[model samples]
Target: MLELACISKTFNPGTVNEKKALSGVALRLEKGDFVTIVGSNGAGKSTLFNAIAGAFYVDEGAIRLAGEDITFKPEYKRSREIGRLFQDPMRGTAPHMTIEENLALAYLRTAKNQNAFFSRTSKAEKQFFRDRLALLDMGLEDRMKQPVGLLSGGQRQALTLLMATLVPPKLLLLDEHTAALDPSTAEKVLGLTREIVAEHHITTMMVTHNMKNALELGNRTLMMDSGRVVLDIGGEERKGLTVEDLLKRFKAGAGRELDNDRILPSE
Candidate 1:
């Protein structure tokens, strides 16, 4: 479970370049909810994720995850409960580290292993890592000794997804994680995301540019613009919804038609 209340953030306040990235943003997520976000550029989608991930403290509001206040929690401390993925495949893993070594680092960094002062690996843990990597079905299990830098973008992204969920954090933040991959590879990674999140009943939020994916992949969809959540749809309201319907709602909430210059890509 997660809750964000009255979240507001401003950059370069009181200056010529001052801009508010998020404004009075509020959201609640129940366990097992997969909410996909759609918006044009500068709509505060990634800002919301960063605020929750402790990339920076919000100028206002509070954030709580799994019953603890993390409003001012340090980024490293929040890592134990929050798992995040970026559009860049190289962001989360060590390029020089072997496949199993990367997995061990993530496995050891989570809350369950937080109390242990020593970062030790055993055969049992390696076997567990192998089993987890095998789930990707990309032959990574057998390539455990290879450095991550040797992998293709899609392979590394899939491996990052596995690492993020190897322990199933309290919440998962995905920032257009598949946007940079080829269509075929992106489809594969998206399928893996659906399976792993469903299997663990993880509460997750994903930022995406593709409108069709926003509607189709997750149980709920949120539309944000100008730093505020403009539309939140789920259940019957979201069922059978079309891209046209979503655009109309965006207009109603944001007091203008969706920006054409920053159009959301749809299939």
Candidate 2:
């Protein structure tokens, strides 16, 4: 459903701080593929997602979603084809908006009729929102009138997840989505992630620093270093592997051990 062909990106070019973020990086995902990505700082994990999401255009190469080129599309134009949840829970939702209002916005995002008016709370919309929110089992339905700013970090993240997947875009990009939550909350969010992805059969690419999560969540796991992907493991081979085995493979493939600081312990 998504393809990145020979993509390359560089930051601060022609300056002292010049750094290459992607170097001829290429990736392809079939419909319903769930790929987990892990890499240390400066490994271009976020850069790759940004490139695909059109946060910024890549220095060179083409990106296609569902067989259409979107390399030069602006971020907002690409929103219809992609769903993203950022590292910060606070970044995804509007602080001043009520829970129901936030969901209304997402619903409007996928609305086909351009002439329809947007509402903060329609009975039909509220019913749909309540059903979706109930999946989190977090009593969000009871707080639809509350400002999103009042929610806890985990609650906000859960709400963000629902908002992102409400319409089932062509691709889902999760960039360190649970990194800011507490261990228990992170685990809960991760489980929610798996459940939603599986239920919808969405094509997802998740960037994570947690080794165990990378190894456990997706159908395939990729390890990146510097500006390129160095390791790809999947299928029966990756099914029973542990964190230590993944680290060893990363070191052998990248010619360097996995950075200790980036390998989050199992929570």
Candidate lDDT (C-alpha), each = 0.90, 0.90
Please give each candidate's TM-score: 0.96, 0.96
Give candidate 1 misplaced runs (Cα > 4 Å).
111-119, 260-265
Question: What is the lDDT for 120 in model 2?
Answer: 42
Model 1 Cα lDDT, one tens digit per residue, 91-115:
8999998998889888888746445
Residue-level lDDT of model 2, residues 1-267, one tens digit each, is: 988899999999999999999999888889998999999898999989989988899989999999999999989878877999999999889999999889888767766677655574478878999999999999998999999999999999999999999888889999999999998999899999999999899999999988888888879999999999998888999998988889889889889987748568464
Q: Model 2 Cα displacement at 108 (Å)?
A: 1.2
